[model samples]
Target chain A: MQETIEKVTKVVKKKRAKFPESYIHDIARAAERHDLDDDELDELVRRVKRAYERAKVEKGEAVGTVAAQSVGEPGTQMTMRTFHYAGVAELNVTLGLPRLIEIVDARKKISTPTMAIYFEDEFKNDEEFVRTIANKIGKSNVNDILQDFHVNFAEMNVVAELDETKIKDKRLDFTDIINRVEKAFKKAQIDNNILSFVPSKSNIRELRLLADKVRDLQISGVKNIGKVVIRKEEDEWVIHTEGSNLGAVLKMEGVDKVRTTTNDIHEVEKVLGIEAARNAIIHEAQRTMDEQGLTVDVRHIMLVADMMTADGSVKSIGRHGISGEKASVLARASFEETGKHLLRASIRGEIDHLTGIIENIIIGQPIPLGTGSVGVVMKHK
Target chain B: MKHEMVPDHAVLSKSESNKVLKKMDIHLEQLPKIKSDDPVAKSIGAKEGDILEITRKSSTAGKFITYRLVKD
Candidate 1:
């Protein structure tokens, strides 16, 4: 083993390519396993060296442009419609081009916010337990629990008749609903599953406004999470929610916090910080592309994600984010709002160093990329 | 086989991380980054600017060491 290692090291040292130590060790092990003589070992080392040399990226290669083209070209081929989630008919997710645009734009509120919540080990297979957890995570308003709402214009009061069956089905107490409504409106009165709201002054408009407020009042569960559909996948049950409330859902008991993911990027940012948000952008973009049978490299997604979150926050690719905030005045102007950007820069006495690609391109010059990145210096002897 | 079963991951000390940076002749930003919220980064409590050393089992070599900068 020692002799083989020594021969491999000697051959690697002589090679021009800077092969990693692991590669050298690998060659030595393979040579030993084959029981190769000195000549065979040397040939093996040479082949490994050649492969390493071939694998390395060449200097002055326009990587950024290549990455952009690789991603953008396939992006044009992505589907334009929202896709129905697998197994669940009612649940739909914004996929393809719109989703890609949303990710790049770093939009705070997504068109259809969704969450896939997995349960902990104890509650994983228990359908009843999972259903209870889903109910807890789902937002329930007074209108959702109430069967009928009657208005007594003469008395200037609104009466909400609570659904007894729904309250029982959801495992919610009638008093709990009453208490919640009472907290929102002081003049609320409870009588045998009938919650009444009396206006201070007897008026039709005031009664109508009070009734609207009472109808929209959230009685229980996490806010913004409207519907949760629990589906059994193999042995375990997963909760798929229509509305995403990542912050609240994560804190809930029986929830597998680590695996639970939401479609809303900003919600993820708020709950898990900017780094998690960057990951979400990458994961979401890749998933969108993959679902449409488009294959873009993971590194491209990483590069885009890194650029989006480089400033410790998620920023859109276009103006009002990364492009608009460029160091060079001309680069900013060239991206969007050319007149406004140029005017502002001139008024502020800003100078363009012609550093970025866009700025250089606008002035009809070779951009500082590839061969144009460096300038030759003449030496006087 | 045991070593291959579990790849070793460790957080480099401040001085060790600096030495790595010096040896590579690269700034922290130049290194490939891993998010601070990454599972491995979180396990070691690796903050932004911290360097993580991951040693993976290799078939050719006994082990292969790689470094990643933890970023926000």
Candidate 2:
């Protein structure tokens, strides 16, 4: 024990010798300003340095004295964002500063955390390669991780990455948006000419098939808002589209099965083909507006949902979504109890469940929180 | 190969040598393995059934490796 203590002391002394004189001066200044005694300051510095040393073993910014004070900020709120992957329809997700911090931290080191991530859109999906990248990133050594995954942590912009991840989506709640663009247009001194044309009822199925093509619009692909017209041009079956993929429209007009579009951007051609998803969001928002007594339009919902889900993959809104387990549990608690109750519960213990304990049995068919039977109360008078 | 002691206990076995090398981020291939029948063994005047000790980190820890030349 004495030998071990001596050895540990030697190591500590060596480490303290490496600590810059400037650091000690800074600590001394803060201590004097804060009215903390010099002895207390020295002890605090030693503790912080120990923590910093421990932190250096992991992948992140070293948890120094400054980091120890600013662990987490309470009373902060989160906003939603959208991100698109491989140019599929937008998938929405909730985002905030915490989420931003996560992205910044993730990008701090070259290696990223990996899950059983499923790539949704086309751009040559390599599940195996991506999984390999995930596994490599999960390791300790950043040098090894970067070499294995080919990522440069030093070059990454943490703030920009946070902004991109947390604020990428432009999705609005249905209740939060105006239901129609006419009011917005009126406010902005502009009007969109609605050129109405009635198509024949015999080709309704064909129109639906053509509408299915809207999902393939990518960053490199043509962008078009479609308006289908079925007016006969010289006795021919003319299925004309106003501001959509002319190629997609032509393919549907002349064929039976709908074919995918190629990567091309011609002049004065199709606008971004987000109409079907846009319409779906609009209709859902309209329903919410009606239910919630809101006057918001489908477009705003589309924009918000689009912002949230601009990424090709649609993350679910429930506990299973991208947020951490603590946040998810908090979200679940909000449904069971009041928001304040949940906050109180959170503060009562540092973890989501401090007092929450496991039980072996219950009154009803016990819904176990862990593996076996969980206990629910049945208090008798 | 001759200078390399073929230990009676085989303390520095093939796998053990490789494992030590691995901890140092190297391989046995990176180390100069002595032959069992090299003339340097005769020069050191080491006979068969004699023990040869190779110190590593410290003598007390026995992280220091030794071999017994018990082979013909």
Candidate 3:
């Protein structure tokens, strides 16, 4: 009730118009079918009128004061009879439905508040009364209400394209999933065209394999390559000039100053071809999944690997690639020193706390820390 | 009389019950108002100001109570 009042007051202040109580009374009918008692109804009108009065004062024009909620399109909703099925009881609820015509955007929603009251199932064993109630709600609405359990579909976002090829892993492709979704929509005759393609079990397995292959650089380009180093102090940052007469190291923009002790030829080759490696990773990942005849989008593979990889040197799906979040603690413990304290804390921390007792004995009398503050404590529950 | 005009589903509603009683050549003081809070109106899915026709299949002799919705 307060919310409605505030809403009305705000809208009235915005529009700045004045209308008679009857006019305000009419607008308040939007929620009239909510079955509010007289007091609630009166309160709603009072708030609406107050809104108009406020608008009038703010705008300094009595006649021009108007609230945003216009009078009477009442949205074609009318009071009706309904049976609301809840947990264990079926309530014979008086309902109001918006029966008017309007177009709602796929992005928009209209909320209609409702209240259900439980009453005796007087119609029990009374088929005629039951039929009357059903008929009044209409067959179409009944059908809609019955089939309300069907799930919805969401739109798809394509990340990578998969080409049919050979690989070590098998998974379904994305396009194929999209095809299945579109076909489902068509078959179901659902009005919504949007759908979310949830990854299935097989899809996840293939995606994992793809992540491993791409990170290893068995094919495609080098995408997972980290920091590069060069051999000859002069060739470190510079592109390799020892090629079949290509632009060579120093000639490539910003490559002239590479000073490295790590083999310059391989260093420059890897540096100049980082993109090729990344693409190669992408290609391999795609092939791994594609080999299984799965048409999954390549983006998922890339996301998994990128999210998993912290350091490229340790190319692994277990901790380095996909399970990285859980793998770190395990890796540090297994590869390095394990903490006895941590293990003890994990095992007996709760038991230790529970065992420690602090009680007042009065001297041992159990005089405790708060012993001097006996009468200072007051608690109310 | 109103019930005669309406379908068999019509009853002196919570709101219209008094009016119906008056039409039957009786006064609100004479016939029952079927208090707005009566369990009967709830059973027919009628609220204040709404009317419904109920048929009492086996109870109270009457086939049903076509009552108006009221706040009592």
Number of the top DockQ candidate:
1
Interface RMSD of each: 9.8, 34.2, 40.6
Candidate 1 wrong stretches, greater than 4 Å: A1-49, A82-87, A147-149, A153-156, A359-367, A373-375, A378-381, B1-13, B27-72
TM-scores of all candidate predictions against the true structure? 0.77, 0.16, 0.15
Over A188-221, each residue of candidate 3 has an lDDT whose tens digit, in order, gives 2223322322223235554454333322322211
TM-score of chain A of 2: 0.18
Worst 10 residues of 1 chain A by lDDT: A80-89
> Among these predicted structures, which one has the highest lDDT?
1
Considering DockQ, where higher is better, how would the candidates rank from best to worst? 1, 2, 3
Clashes of each: 1, 45, 64
**Model 1, residue B69: what's the lDDT?**
80
Candidate 2, superposed: residue stretches over 4 Å from native? A1-250, A253-280, A283-295, A298-304, A307-311, A316-328, A336-381, B1-72
RMSD of each: 6.2, 28.7, 36.0
Candidate 3 residues lying further than 4 Å off, grouped into runs, are A1-269, A272-276, A308-314, A319-381, B1-72
- Which candidate comes out best when scored by TM-score? 1
